[model samples]
Target chain A: MMTLAHTKYIVLAALIFCLTPIFSQAEGLIADQKFKADNEIFVTFSGAVDRAVAENIANYTVFEEPDPDIQLELESATLSEDSTRVSLRFKEPLNTAMTHVVSIRGLAGIDKTTFTVSKSYLGYLFGILISALLINNFVFTKYLGLCVFFGTSKKKETAKGMGVVFTLVMVVSALMSWFFYNFILIPYDLNFLQIVVFIGLVSLTVQAVDTVLRKVNPILFNSFGVFLVLVIANCVIIAVPLILANNNYNVFETFMLALGAGGGFLLALYLMSSVSERMQLAKIPPTFKGLPIAFIVAGQFAMAFLGFSGLQIF
Target chain B: MANDKSSMQLITRGILSENPIFKLALSMCPAVGISTTVMNGIMLGIAVLFVQVFSSVTISLFKNLIHPRIRIPTYTLTIATWVTVIDLVLAAYMPEAYAKMGIFVKLIVAFAIITMRLEMFACKESVNDSFWDGLGMGLGFMVGMVVIGFVRELLGSGMILGYDVLGFKPLLFFILPSAGFFVVGLMMAFFNWIEVYYKRSKGLK
Candidate 1:
């Protein structure tokens, strides 16, 4: 009986060893390589890259001319055990060929890490939808643009108009933030000025959007622009890009985050407006008449959204 | 601007008549964001209280010196300076709290409560009145935050002050931002109900 047990134990150990690699292999690492210019490539190996190859590649760069516009700043670089993947960062965009070279390196004994130049259009769309409704939820997560959110949301029709305007403003603001951050700020190495720059951008964007909308479509713009100015200085627009920057999400992810934040703002506004409309008729006490009740309602809504915290749908 | 009674009245006004979050509906920014937990609410309240009192006192003392045309700019500068000081202190001493609070600390500059009080009361009132008004409003805001924080933390985590008070599992919905609105609304309704009951029983006014 003792000998039989020993044999079973050995078989179990063998099975565990065999199964471990299969499970580990199922989740392949992704190596992302970005080309900023003709001479510079930013390589990030997510899963596993060969340590020797990564070191060799770094040494080769020392002898080579540095690519203009692609100032390599190693944000973080890591190599997994077994020398399967490597990740690196560059300050600027790289040309496509370097990315392809990194991809080939993965195939050469390193674990295969897929590198796609651009995310699918459908992926972008889906990401936008999800981001608008969930991930970087504006009202819930950022507490931005609340003045307009609470102010115009007192009535349903006004709330609807404000919601549309807020979303448009957010999209415009996000695009502006992206342009400023990527084109000017990052290039100039003025990332520390992000807060001031983004806030100014948001204020300018709101004013520009207001002016354009008013001229192009007066009726619609009138409905929305009333609250647009109010939300211009609000932090939601700038906060979205700040979050995207921290997460280091690609353009697709940034778009999604914008969508989620916008959607979340609209959701909060709609809910608050509907409740406030109902609340208008409710017999509230003199002391707790207007703002007090609104505060309480806002608190309750915030609590309700807490349910979505652990949801890993993203 | 008046005697002790008026000064005392100005102070009391913020606690009820001009309560920042509840009565006046100002400074909803930090109120909603940090009211997720009781601890956050308390910390934020104390921070705001400190800033408000000191800023109000400063504004009142320097009110005559500030130009009328540039009063808004000067007020903003003053508030920003105070906020920056708070920000630095928090960054140095309470790094964890500072990390969690994030940009909201800097946002104190734009918080309508501090600015509104500075413009409306501090600029016009005596130093003592301004100080009391700031304290009252700060306390009122604190009460608002604590109420929301208590409900959110309790229902969301099945705990109060981080202690599991109820054996029952928490309703996760109570912790999200949406729930912040709901909890605040329900609490307001409760407060309203209590006030109504008292008024009806006493036939007051």
Candidate 2:
């Protein structure tokens, strides 16, 4: 009897030991770190963190990964109403180029978890580039530039030319819009005028580029110059500036985004043109031969591109 | 009586023969992008209609003044101005409505159909004719959008206008972005087949 009772107690203890991790995992605090801006970090805990511990600035230590000696001065830590999230504001902008580490010192059950901001500036820019190029392609995913895309993509040579010209035009026009938006539009309290101003700016840029390209390099202009006018009022060109302005991206971020978008457009145009060149021979019903088939083909491509979604590339 | 007959024909033409989405196929971007739900289609359709009509009238009123060499830019500016005015007016007068539909108004600037109508119909026609053309084109586009949305929403979500109808999603693919192209493509083909069959029955080419 003594041996049997001892064996039963041992079995109970072993079961409890096996289930301890599961219980802790369900109850323990999990911190999700997100960079809201250069100077703001939002940390969301899995469970409600204690109000005093979360609000205490001393409980947190933030520093750039490369330079741990210089601790960032946490100006204020604002806890959300439910105590699940906390907003930590710093005196200076955290160096986005480097990974940032935030360590919670005295939370009750959390063992001084040092949560690191996952993506650095380069990583963030890369994310944007990949996202624009593959995940959320302007042409395939967002459905911009379809008119120009369909019009010019019938032939590979024209498609290639249009793609290069489009990238150049997009990059230049996006930069100009950025300069105008930051220097002119914001300072004068003319936010309401962005649509009109962006349209005017795009038209001016295209015209100016047309003239300058024709004068500077006639051969280059002749190859793709005809497409310059068509670029104006193109949704893709207009969307980049509007997006950058809305997100308040800085100069470098804007440049990267424009490059990615332009590159993505070019990639899409090239792929579609290649497929269409081969599709010239495919037999089909008369009704599905032209634009209808093109759309269906595009739908197939869109389905293929959908595989790239939810990919983490950092 | 002749003027009245022509006016009626002009308006009805946009609705039937020259329907923007089905017949002309000018603005496929919004038709494919924003026609995921019936409400979205209606809202965007109304915004496009407002901008299209106003810009057409404004351009038609001043077509003679615009230089032929720079008319494209002028047309674009006119469209942009109308879009801005609509945005501002809605934001000021109807804050709640603006919050829902304001973004659609701004996107009107880039829609090809608006500028296409301005160049082809409005600039060449008189103000009264331009108004009718805009209304017809707008209504046609709205009808096209509603049809696409109705089909997509029905198949995609098993619901219509947020109400569960089918009890389960039929074809989940219809809700995805890729399905937009397929739906539009199939719809276009269907329309083409109908036109051909109708012509055959009427003893016309």
Candidate 3:
């Protein structure tokens, strides 16, 4: 039982077990950092570090990037159980919009890092809304749904009606598709069929809207009925669901995207219709009279819309 | 001989007389959205070509089996299937191009051009004729995309296929989304003018 080979094996096993902790905690660099809250930051080191140096409040400084002279006071520095992460709490909340920096002195391998506090939920939603509506307006910027955009935009009345119907269809279909994608398709591993599924959903949504509108209010249906069917083929309606799915957006975010896109389409249609209604009078060239001229005018609108790029809503 | 001549005419009609982008004004979205570079235009062009031809032939062969009441949905199903095939092939073979194209590839199902051709020509024609028609229309679309890409790249970036020929950008505006509309509109007007002149000369003859 106490042979020399067996003793050698036991000694090797014991040595390996004893060396794992030291090997695991060999590196001393900061591994990761998170801007957890306005008044708190969590910095994780690659390995176990010196606790005395990490917990010292005097060694840490936090300040906005623009002004480095006025440093925020650190209330406390606490080390985690593993001694690899340190939480730095400040006396005051950092500004959300400003770029912030955190520096640690007397730490050998920790480098300074910059971060910004996460946007609030409402702020994030507002950003998506304004982004879709103005910044990345589907009609002018992305060149989506131009078929209906140009078709119904000849007259303001028709444009407004079509816009309303299109918006209603877009929001409903987008939400329905999002539900199907997240709940049914993803669980079943059927993402490849999203195109077929989304198109089918859009068609069904349009048909349902058509029937319900006719029964609920015949007069309103008569005015809006023609554009309801066309909503099935509109790329904007399809694009919204695909985008939401691609980005893994939740229900409210999907709603906001759909609403913003629909609103942007409506605004573009109304504006184009207003100008085209007047454009019927001022055209001089024969070849460039109808659609060609309309395109050039739309190009100008696109140019103007480009100015909305990088606009901060929140 | 007559069938051959008609086939030739069918192919040529889509390119010159009834071009999808310029003449029919269908599928304007992709023409502007993806034609920023020559390579992008060609890739989408080839993808659409395959989808168009395959869908056309399938719908033509199965036109009788599909019910008239629900033909639109059936046609959409066929197109979506072909598009899915292309989408997968591209994703597997060319990840970089697929990344650039993004959702537009999936949105091919909503492309008015494919469905319009299926409804207008494929359903009514023989399988052979439908193939020719699809090939012609697809080629016409490809040609249109290449030309737009050429102009945009040449003027916008002063380069062609990543080659810096001009050494300096010309307008720099042609690459913008607005310039896509402008170029397309101007080209449409130019074609209109040429058509008018051709008609006037023929009347005199």
Each model's Cα RMSD? 16.0, 16.0, 14.7
The residue-by-residue lDDT of candidate 1 on B108-173, one tens digit each, is 655767877888888988888788888888788888888788888888888887888996757988
Ranking by TM-score: 3, 2, 1
Task: Please provide, for model 2 over A175-198, each residue's C-alpha lDDT reduced to its tens digit, 9 standing for 90 to 100.
Answer: 999999999999999999989999
Clashes of each: 57, 0, 0
Q: Encode model 3's per-residue lDDT on B57-158: one tens digit a residue.
A: 999999889888999999888998999899999999999999988778888888898999999889978899999999999988988998999999999999
Candidate 2 lDDT (Cα, 0 to 1): 0.84
Model 1 CA lDDT for position A277? 83
Off by over 4 Å in 1: A1-129, A140-147, A171-225, A232-238, A241-245, A248-256, A271-314, B1-8, B54-78, B126-128, B151-160, B163-178
In terms of DockQ, which candidate is stronger, 1 or 3? 3
iRMSD for every model: 4.0, 1.3, 0.8
Best first by lDDT, ranked: 3, 2, 1
- Please list all clashing residue pairs in model 2, or write none if there are none: none
- Per-residue lDDT tens digits for candidate 1, residues A222-247, read 66667775664455765676776655
What digit string (tens of lDDT, one per residue) describes model 3 on residues A100-157? 5666766754454333333445577788889899989999999998777778889999
Worst 10 residues of 2 chain B by lDDT: B1-10
> Which parts of model 2 are misplaced by more than 4 Å?
A1-118, B1-5, B89-104, B203-205
Q: Considering only chain A, what is the TM-score of each predicted structure? A: 0.59, 0.67, 0.67
- Model with the higher TM-score, candidate 1 or 3: 3
Residue A109's lDDT within candidate 2 is 59
